[model samples]
Target: MHGYVHKRLASTAAKLAVAPSAAKAFPPPDAIHNPRTFEPDTYAALQPPPASSLSALAHRLGLGLILSPTEVQQACTHSSFVSFYQKHYPKEPKPASNANLASLGNSLLGLFASEYVGASYPYMPTNIMKAVVSGYVGSKTCAAIASEIGAAPLLRWHRTPPTPLSPAPLLLHDALSSISRSIIALVYQHRSLPVTRQFVHDLFLSREVDTRAMFKFRDPKKALKLLVDKFNRERPISRLLSETGRFSNSPVFVVGIYTGADQLGEGFGTSLKMAEFRAAEDALLRVFLTRTPPEQLSLPSSTFSPTQSELYKPRKRPEPEYIPGEIGMEEMLYASSGKSGYLNPTPSLRD
Candidate 1:
């Protein structure tokens, strides 16, 4: 009885939250789902980086946006270096320096891109939605891109997390709003606008493609430099982050893996195409852009696993015309049948 009452109260709370009339019905949302899974603290500190820095960023042509100092600092500090920091100086105070701020600003801007994409395109399926967001959140991706522009000084920070009022991290925390502002500004100047959702989606998608394929072409910022140049002579998405001035080929991060549901892996493919497709597909499902079929996929959402999907009962068969309910087939075929609807006037199966 206690359990039953508790369940009723929980159901009532859920119903009240969503308004039962609005949604038909829904199970609880998965707590651990979403692309930005790492603790915000992972990027919280812009502690001073070691001299073994990736500061010599190769510049690519046609990246119109001016590279910010903070952006560069954030890109320089990679996970490997962070580990080194933890191993060596775990208890040192945060760096109170301009260089560190610039580095963190880069990361802040990169994450801002995803949030912008999400707010901009609500129709992109959840998978693509998550992919775009997560790609930007990627530490390697940020470092690679920032390395391009020589922004890999990996800024040091002695300050607290930026509050809501100050755009210390990003001048415009809202991505779509920035785009909207851009559109408005363009319209005001040119007296025309080509602000289509499809165009924006494609633009962002191209950026994402280049970002995921960063390790391929050497320079983080200029990975797609050649490709973008062929089309429009632009530096490409990779170069936008790598502002300092160097480009070199490196191994691709997401390549040739067989991760499913909660599982993750690392492998290599002989060719770039092979590696990228394999990685992207794995990433798509891993990021919950597409849901795994319940039977085979051991999703991370399960706190208790080795459990089956919710069971559903088989549909009851319809009654025949002669019987009040389903009369046994054996009785119907044989002459020694009991009183079914045919032998009785009361409550016919047909009724």
Candidate 2:
């Protein structure tokens, strides 16, 4: 058996050696072992430009001039662009992508939004708080803001052949939002927290949020019940504040929701049930529509000293002061509408 196997192996080797395509199948040992022969030349086309060019791009975005050229370039460069570049230029080193920067920016935006909303509206329900944060930093809003500022046009994308009737690519919106976040991250990296915070305020927080409209209760009465239970308060009682023209074509009923001596909210409607629902909604709004003065708002990052020689050093920062006042949805709306006689001045980062 051993002699037969040895003969078979010798025959196979002889046959392979005599084959016409054997050279094609296996190259010379030196050729096969050479590392430099197969190596490709390094080339990366979409590398970030010089500091002057990046600063020009930043100026186009209405940003105050700073010296974070590479960061700004990376912020604008999407992963799709990087992938495309790498695919076409296989030998080139992979350039920096915005994924990490976008992630960091997203976290920072969420943190700032949560801190602002939480401090402003301490008693706001969890669901409402989430909605508010979404309004500020959600993709839809970010995309809209990006497009409004012409950042969408400035976004770098991989060039591909256009197909007829192809589904519209979502990369534009995705890239725009990413670029926005990356820009924020870049600012935070190059500058101090206070500078980044100011940038966020000017860009995002300055926009007025419709706190009342944000509330979408499927059943206001049920929600009110749950809220009362959570607070360990007496069940809410709806009382008829007033009524007029009950038998006429036009009827109005004013209802108020109360718990013990505290009147939660009041509403006017055409019927008792409608008035009760409106009152419940009003009560929920009252509970959720708390606001703090912009000057008094505190950020969690303030607890850490940016000047610390070592990491995780606690700093002495003044605690945020909470001033109790209605959010005044109507006033905020009017102010947002650019109308005269608006009671509340628009909140400005400069303030």
Candidate 3:
């Protein structure tokens, strides 16, 4: 029995050595293993997005400028996707995540927001300006904007676990927003500041923000007084202008806010007190929400020299005339302290 078993083992070894396909199945021991020898057909989703799709997305976004394949890939790639790639393709170089670019884009968005807000509404309180900026490029707003631009389908990421209340099971709002920021970062990195600025403005800042509605006055009367005092004007006085249906349940009262002989603003409400409060709020809005004319407005970055930049082209034409902005006065009258009141204006812009 032992002799028969030894002979069977020897015969099998000889047969395997003589087989034609055995060399292909078992390569030389010294040969380096190449994972690419076989196609990674199993993980089709791990592949980079096609150029045509990226082009279509760029067209939809109206980026105007072209992005390199690497830039586009990096911008659209999430960290989860990168991690998955690293795990699967251990021997291959790891792809970079959009986290760094998103950070850069976040800062750029903020800089542009502050400069634009400050110039456009010079007297707008600091906190309100921040709120307006957040309204434009905030996480919630970015997700909505990205969705409208059809960017969600282009993103490459591993589906993260969703919160109980989240609408998207595969994606988070922060991740969605990061796509926009990363794209913005790529635009800035590969293109000029002017182009980047235009891209940001056309996409993010172009959305209309209700400057008047953003103002929530905790003490409208007191704020109005502070506002007038900053201008060296007389204290605001709220006077009942007209009234109708005084005996009725829904009595309408019209009140006008005045400083000296000039009427600051007027409002109509169900009661005289309500009318006065509204009138004061109206007066505050008129002063704080004054917008610079679009034609007269100029961003500080617009004057930047293209020659100084590494990526941008040299300027062929003369620069536009620069218009200096007026210094803004402080009137810390908005509601931000508690649940409703806004914080005070920035110290630099205040009296």
Candidate 4:
């Protein structure tokens, strides 16, 4: 048996020596599966296009110049594409996907949104503030923004092992939102926070919010009562401010809400009841929609610097403290139901 094995090995060596092409064509069993053994030409042919090819997409997104076009490509690539590539080339290293980039982008978006909202509307109530931020960066809104910027067609997806049963990959709302966020993350990584802030502002925050339409009161009358009670004010009295063509086909009535001599808000409507409701709505808007100029608002990112020293600190400038409910106090006097009004001499009706 040993003699036979030696003879077979000698014969194989003689055949390999005689046919050098056989040696090159048939590698060892172990090396056959090795990814490094694959030719660079083969890999290059199978690989996706480089980042520079996506210049049109970058321009469409208003990203004039990009340092890392590869990163941008990865940001546009969905997990499905990576899965398809891995299925075909299990031995090769899996390409990067946008999942992690999307997560990072989400956090950065939240930070910028909070800063913008907080700075612009310092006195906005917590609930309304939350709603405003949600309205700005919510998945639906982000998806819409992405669609408007022509990102849907640029998104990359692959359905591997093309089969009749395989469902076609679609650009979903969440996926679009993730892509949008990943793009923001890419901007932040390659650029500075200020640039990212400006990008976010121009893309998302620049749009105006319909404050009145966003207000969803379960019971405006009850909410107003609670608001008045909390402020220790008199029960709001709806007074007729003006009326034109009272009995005509198209009559207009204006109503003003008063707490003693203070006129909180006024509204015009087709009917007396609608005018009163509009007046209440107007009052709510005044209490909630207090605004500050965008330029005047300060952001937490303003303090960040790549090379600023900790020891060489400047003296802290006194910033005006903003209490959450300070706006209401400035606009309307708060009176205690138990005692006399603190800011005003007039006693509340409950007292």
Q: Name the best candidate (by TM-score).
A: 3
- Model 2 C-alpha lDDT per residue in residues 118-205, reported as the tens digit of each score: 7788667666678889888877777777667655544555644455764555455766788778888888887777678778878998
Lowest summed-lDDT stretch of 10 residues in model 3? 23-32
Pitting candidate 1 against candidate 4, the one with the higher lDDT is 4
lDDT of 2: 0.66
Give the lDDT of residue 79 in candidate 2.
76
lDDT of each prediction vs. the true structure?
A: 0.32, 0.66, 0.72, 0.65
Q: Where in model 3 is the C-alpha error above 4 Å?
A: 1-48, 62-65, 84-93, 159-171, 307-321, 331-351
Query: How many residue pairs clash per model?
Result: 35, 0, 5, 0
Error of 1 at 158 (Å): 16
lDDT of 1 by residue, 102-178 (tens): 34433444444554544344323334455556565443444344334333223322223466886454321221122
lDDT by residue for model 4 (170-237), tens:
44776677678888888888787778888898899988777556666544454465467667888889
| TM-score per model over all chains | 0.22, 0.64, 0.74, 0.66
Deviation of model 1 at 163, angstroms: 27
Q: Report RMSD for candidate 1.
A: 31.2
Q: How do all the candidates rank in terms of TM-score, highest first? A: 3, 4, 2, 1
Off by over 4 Å in 2: 1-54, 60-65, 68-70, 86-95, 158-171, 229-235, 248-250, 311-351
> What does each candidate score in C-alpha RMSD?
31.2, 17.9, 12.6, 14.4
Model 2 CA lDDT for position 24: 25
Residue 193, candidate 2: alpha-carbon lDDT: 77
lDDT of 3 by residue, 202-300 (tens): 888988877667767677786676567667788778889999999999899999998899999999999999999889888878878889999888889
For residue 24, model 3's alpha carbon misses the true position, in angstroms, by 23
